[model samples]
Target: MSSLYGLRPLPSHGRFGYSAITRRPGYAWPNGARLAVYLGFNLEHFAFGEGLGARIGPASPEPDVLNYSWREYGNRVGAWRCLELFDQLALPTGCLLNTALYDHCPELVSAFAARGDELIGHGHTNAERQGDMPEAQELALLAGCHARIAQESGTAPRGWLSPWISESRTTPDLLAETGYDYTLNWAHDDQPLP
Candidate 1:
């Protein structure tokens, strides 16, 4: 009887099964804190005009410099400023990182790693959606992201956030099989769920 009209049906016997919010037992966060706040600091890279991206203006022809440059600025300047602010506030962030960011700007990624932030895999790029890829291709994509981030960051990430929040039917299976501890694709929960 559980359903959300447009979404695919919840998987059977999945890692976390369906239960009414009211029926679940009360939970307390670590340190008995009533609330937990973690920043999702996204550092992404994008392919030019070939895949999905945000734009500062209306879409133009190929090689959309307007939009591409806008996104690039985040890596070049904005993210660094944000990191400084986070440091000033003495906050720890959960870095949502695209593997492509390592290729595009390794130093920037290093800045976050050096700050003791937790790097969460965010795929290779936001240019393409993973949801429509074939099963094998999707698996490779997942593995590639994990490998590249591990190689560059010196530690494999334990969490994932699909590129553009895109995912295939088997994304969860891929995550579990490939050694990721959790994913951010599910947005309904305020707390991490098993």
Candidate 2:
């Protein structure tokens, strides 16, 4: 049986003696079999010592906000390593990009865009919470994210995947109003209900 984190059990059979066994989200169920493949990647890293981060704006994301470095990580190098690995594999991935990432690494964004990779908004930065921020601030920052996306990818985003899955009550409604196609801030269900 397919599972994530190797702990959560699969769902049981529902009504009519049927169980959905989906492998990934947005996939077609074959004869009530739930199976799908996910194409996703999270791109995050810091350039400085990995502490205070860029510390530019009032809402700049924290670069770990703790130590300069740690086990199994490097400052500003993780993304490049991942990029190289993905490029070598010729794999397509969806980048849940923090706008700060774009502002910080335009070249990296270009690399992904060149591969036709999907870039979903991950807030203007990875620090302040879009779901927690005031609505006005959120909207303004979202607009800024699109502007930067265009600047980096040469196109505006059609989706939003908030950082850390920072979902709010109004996130769906707001994204709908903003003309987004979908969101990736909820539990991953194999069935495409929404």
| Candidate achieving the largest lDDT | 1
Worst 10-residue lDDT window for candidate 1 reads 1-10
Q: If candidate 1 were superposed on the true structure by all CA atoms, what would the RMSD be? A: 3.8
Superposed model 2: Cα runs more than 4 Å off: 1-35, 45-75
**Pairs that clash in candidate 2:** 21-34, 22-34, 22-35, 23-35
The CA lDDT at 178 in model 2 is 66
**Superposed Cα RMSD, model 2:** 9.7
Best by TM-score: 1
Question: In each prediction, how many residue pairs overlap at the backbone (N, C-alpha, C within less than 3 A)?
Answer: 0, 4
Residue-by-residue lDDT tens digits, candidate 2, 1-194: 44655678567423123336654345556686666556777655444533223333343244443342431143257767888898898878888777766566667767778889988877765545566778777667767776777677777788788765776666777777666777777654545445
Residues 46-160, candidate 1: write the lDDT tens digits.
9976888977788878888888999999999999999889999999999998888777899999999999899999988988889989999899988998888888878988999
- Cα-based lDDT at residue 117, candidate 1: 94
Q: How does model 2 fare in lDDT?
A: 0.65
Candidate 1, lDDT over the whole model: 0.87
